[model samples]
Target: MLKKITLVVATTLLVTACGSNSETAGSGSADSGQSDKVYKLKLAATWGPTLTPFIDASQNMAKMAEEMSNGRLKIQVDPSNKHKSPLGILDLVKSGQYDMGHTATYYYKGKDLATIPFTAMPFGMTSTEQQGWMYYGGGLELMQKVFKPHNIVAFPGGNTGMQMGGWFKKEINTVDDFKGLKMRIPGFAGEVIAETGAVPTTIPGGELYTALDRGTIDALEWVGPSMDIKMGFHKIAPYYYTGWHEPGAELHYLVNDKAYDKLPADLQQILKTAMRVSADDMSVRTQHMNAEFLAQMKTEAPNVQIKTMPPAVLNELKAINDRLVGDMVNESPMMKEIIESQQAYQTKARNWGKLADYQYIKDNQ
Candidate 1:
């Protein structure tokens, strides 16, 4: 009887320990669901397959996310050519047809006036200052407010530093030169140009050269030297003017709200970090390419003449820009809020920039 009693006790202890071990294993499985589950996402971009820096931002972000997540997160990017919806990225992401999208915010101006300020403003902050406002000056929060209602989250994808005004077939010597001018411009800048008695139109990247070559547009403002060189605009329009409209043109990445919410906490953080790293890389890479290509312009396009718009013309354009923006602020409360925030931040940042960057450049030159 004693031996039988001891055997029963030992058997009970073994069963109890086995139960405890089973519970621990269940807890580990729960954690593994959050940490190790594989997520595959699709991204639709507004750019063509081979457009560098623009396409590079999306590609790099995908690559970084996969590596950072150790293959648990995979993003596949589809270019405009394959998707056949270059301008429909926002809609695609919003409907969850695409998990993400890469495009410019200004493209959605017709959808929401509040979206316009996020891209670039005429006579606005430089790229560096704009980025500072974005990361530090409550810009990101404001951006979320604008996007949340659409079931999308937006982040800065990349920036093309101060864009050139446009390539004009004829030189703009005075404000009168804008009269009846047909120019390819976009966003608020298009409105400002229209105020100058110019007909402003938005053309896709693929059709710009054909449109310009065939006299469909008298002038067109693409990007700076790096992008424009490949477009062969210099061969057609000899006059290359300086920038004003898009001082800091920033492209955006849009995330589907539902898709993002479904991600584990660690994956969410990883995705955000990847976006930031890739975006910064694109900004610096763009500057490097622009510098390198600008040097080659003299040899490639001998007829290309770099011209600055006249002071009188610039002053007139600025006045129009201010009036139009003021009108927008009055029209929409959201626009007013965003513009006020940006203006306040720009004022604080501009003062320091003048003392530091502007003065340094003036002194150096």
Candidate 2:
């Protein structure tokens, strides 16, 4: 795992297992390049290099693809620092400017509202439930259905289990406290918060710390302690809130339709399998990092207060979230199918999980 996978623009391009006589897997190349052929891929990421769970997921995917394909597939990951367009990864990949991209479906809600649910929905499925819904419960089909028109095939790249609500400069006790509050939040969660009269600002990952430090933003939600620790938000914000908005925020691995079509059968499967492994690895890694970083926070940043939002405020947000989804569903036929599918799958999955994992955790806590 220590071996480097690949690099990008102003980044190193590593072909780890390339034979000395390897050929290019280019479309017009003579050698049909099966054995020693190297397919060079460029992947743009929405996360900055310092963002762990996201960056780690991208690297792991590249490594898996390289190792599995014996260097036939080499992906160079370019973070926002390199690309300077974290929020625009979807466009980068869709335009074929990049072969692939690591981003969340929710970021492009303005372009396509249907992209929202594939990432996370406020008060929707938990991580486990969402994973089940995605693979075994017809979730991937719906996701593909939404992305097909965009000319990019989206895959589940990574998952951050139950995300922390955010770091707040002040505790939110009542519903009125949300009004006019500026926060760095993304996805549909931003829209959900905006419903409470709060202004939701989508800041790039690298800019969040400066934004919070300079009082440019009142609060922000940047994953859990794992990723946020590097941002040092705890130094400025004392109140760390529990999650409600993003129960299971999922990252997306987007592949350009034309690019993916060029891959041979074996390499295509290898790429898909690599993505699957990366997705699962991120979930486990996130859980581990969250636990370790949280402990680190308690010891180093002792002043940070971990608090849950008051039920009154949570109820208001939940109400708004439900109304928003309900309205979206009624408005878009595709949204209705996707939501109905998710609900039907998640409800049953949650019930089954509740009796075992849920009860065990609940009783112990």
Candidate 3:
């Protein structure tokens, strides 16, 4: 009887162990279908890896997406070098060649004039105002409408608060100074400034410093101190004028509509939130970086005199900008709607800001 009991217990133990192994083997497919599966995406940026603020935005988004998704969703960011197509990001993303792209909306104005207002305008809203308008005052809606035709979804990636006007070899003391001046300024601002006889030319980023140094271009407007310091523009052009052209030059991320639509609901949320947070982060980081570098400029690059464009010069530019915008507004029904929407929002926001932010600064300064 004792031997019979021992044999029965051994048989039961073996049966239980085999059952557990079989269950574990069956669960592997489910694990592969769920938690063990990974999704990889590719992103392209208009900037190289080291370019601050712009490239920082792209890296920040990728890092956050991977962390938040527990490694399920991964994004590989490729800069201009890897792709060798900086100017074609919009078209690439539009055609679903890339999953997403980081670039400026204004870069594509030749294809669509309506893209100008999304980035900035001469004498337009500030970074604060533009951001507020985007989140609260239907600016995002208008941006989407403009980009929808191309099958691209646009989101603000970062902003360069208020860029310095440009670095010039000579001071722009009078409107007459623009006469016969050649500047490597592009976009709508290029058109506005052209009215003043400052012939506008478009040059690639790599060639800008050489162009300025060799007198190929009399002046060029890059970003503020953080970026400008690295370019050594201060050594070549002493006059650093404040901005009017791009009060808030906002950078954007372009996602292919189909690629975005295919993301799981959770991943879609992660991407959107990550982009929003990183964009805000980029704004604050850029401000800090610019401040740090601007201080360095004062001590190290003292010859880099920071000056504002005289009100007279600003007025002239403003007038030309208004006319150009007016012509754009009359072009299409959609242009009229987008421009009108921004102008409407600007009117309401500027008044409150005037008393709140503008007044405080004007009084304190």
Score each candidate by Cα lDDT.
Answer: 0.85, 0.84, 0.82
Cα lDDT of model 3 overall?
A: 0.82
lDDT of 3 at 106: 84
Q: Tens digit of lDDT per residue, candidate 1, span 217-246?
A: 999998898799988998799999999999
Looking at model 3, the pairs that clash are: none
Taking all chains together, each candidate's TM-score versus the true structure is 0.90, 0.90, 0.88
The reply for model 3, stretches above 4 Å from the true place, is 1-36
lDDT of 1 at 165: 92
Residues 40-156, model 2: lDDT tens digits: 899999987877878888888898789778789899999889999999988999899999999988999889999988889888888888888887677877888888898888888
Off by more than 4 A, model 2: 1-33
lDDT, residue 222, candidate 1: 86
Root-mean-square deviation (CA) per prediction: 13.3, 6.4, 13.7
TM-score result, candidate 1: 0.90
